[model samples]
Target: MLVNPHICPAETTVILHICPVEMLVNPPTALAEMSVSPLICPVKTSVSRLIALAEMSVTRHIWPVETLATRWSTVTPVQQRRSSTLAPVQQRRRSTLAPVQQRRRSTLAPVQQRHRSTFSPVQQRRRSALAPVHQRPCSTLAPVQQRC
Candidate 1:
């Protein structure tokens, strides 16, 4: 089975089939119902605090320090207006293609390469009018720019 590089694939597939033991226990309320370990309580609490600190540190590194929310302020109206304008342009570009069109465009070149010899199948397909060479996806354009 193929695994996604960005996530822990083992944890993901296990989640699909069964609830994890930790999830079966409701952490906050269930502590009242069961006899808890004294040593474990401090360890668990510190682990959670460490996780939160680590997450915050990563975010601080990734975004500007001055941008972190302070108690006094809300987002400025000018920033909101600028973001709203850009969002629609991005969404329109994303939403224009139906899944079939998206899939056809994604898979076309890979299919061409698997079928033929050293002669470029893309040029051949263009000549045959199977796909307008002009309609080639943006990924194809990336390599030409990279080479230059």
Candidate 2:
């Protein structure tokens, strides 16, 4: 194969080979190849162009169409049913928890106020700094000594 000296230096050579059918199908692959590697590697322009074109043709047209039908069909009815049913159970659990959550909220406000008044400001700051965000620290910071 004659390597275009302007494109590929004499010291190294690169070759690409492609069938005629691939050239007709995708042209961008060939363009990409010319842009990407011809300067760095010593490849014949025609061959790289053809190879790139062929790759593009396969990627652009052939593979996706071949996959489109099969990929979607692979999801079984059982899996679909499971996913649909699973979503609502999570929603229902949240709805069910709402009333119990409201009850807890009503009871907790007065108790939290009682706690604030009972502890001094320094102790309140110390307790808050040590406490987990979700749970209050009892004045003594011990579960056994905890007040309601």
Candidate 3:
């Protein structure tokens, strides 16, 4: 799967499916075929063009990062504003969550360590007891007979 961090997440899945082989062979023919295919819903002409461009870049073996970045930059101002607004909210969420996460980890670490320390010896003893059974001895007797 092609994952370009520059591209918005919503578009990434769709864009990833635009294969180089399809574009290199013939974008128009490929798009036309895809349009008529029962599986593919009719996409807007602009979206189809973008998919074609993305696929074309794959054929040229160009990294899609720059292309996606440029394309994203050309997105309407409304989308730009929406993204900009989301940035601070995301930052605020991170800033708020960081200390809580750190506190949780700090509290959990000691409990986990204690639990591990208490259980480890018992677990080791159980494993050691089982190990001999797992490593069957070269004996004529069956396991039950050997144990008995």
Best by TM-score: 3
Weakest 10 consecutive residues of candidate 2 by summed lDDT: 12-21
Q: Listing every candidate in turn, what is its Cα RMSD in Å to the true structure after a full C-alpha superposition?
A: 27.1, 19.6, 22.9
lDDT for each candidate structure: 0.68, 0.71, 0.76
Q: Lowest summed-lDDT stretch of 10 residues in model 1?
A: 65-74
Q: How accurate is candidate 1 locally (lDDT)?
A: 0.68
Tens digits of per-residue lDDT for model 2, 17-130: 434346556767866776778665656777799899999998889778655634564666765676677779989999999999999999999999998788878797888886
Off by over 4 Å in 3: 1-71, 123-148
Higher lDDT: candidate 1 or 3? Answer: 3
Cα-based lDDT at residue 45, candidate 2: 71
**Model 2 vs. true fold: TM:** 0.29
Query: Clashing residue pairs in candidate 2, if any?
Result: 14-42, 29-52, 30-52, 30-53
Ranking by TM-score: 3, 2, 1
lDDT of 1 by residue, 1-148 (tens): 2355356577676765464455456655455445467667888999999999999999888676335432224657765666678778888877875676878988997878776655777777667795565677676777876477
Query: Tens-digit lDDT track for model 3 on 29-80?
Result: 8887866774445456667988999899786666565455335767667757
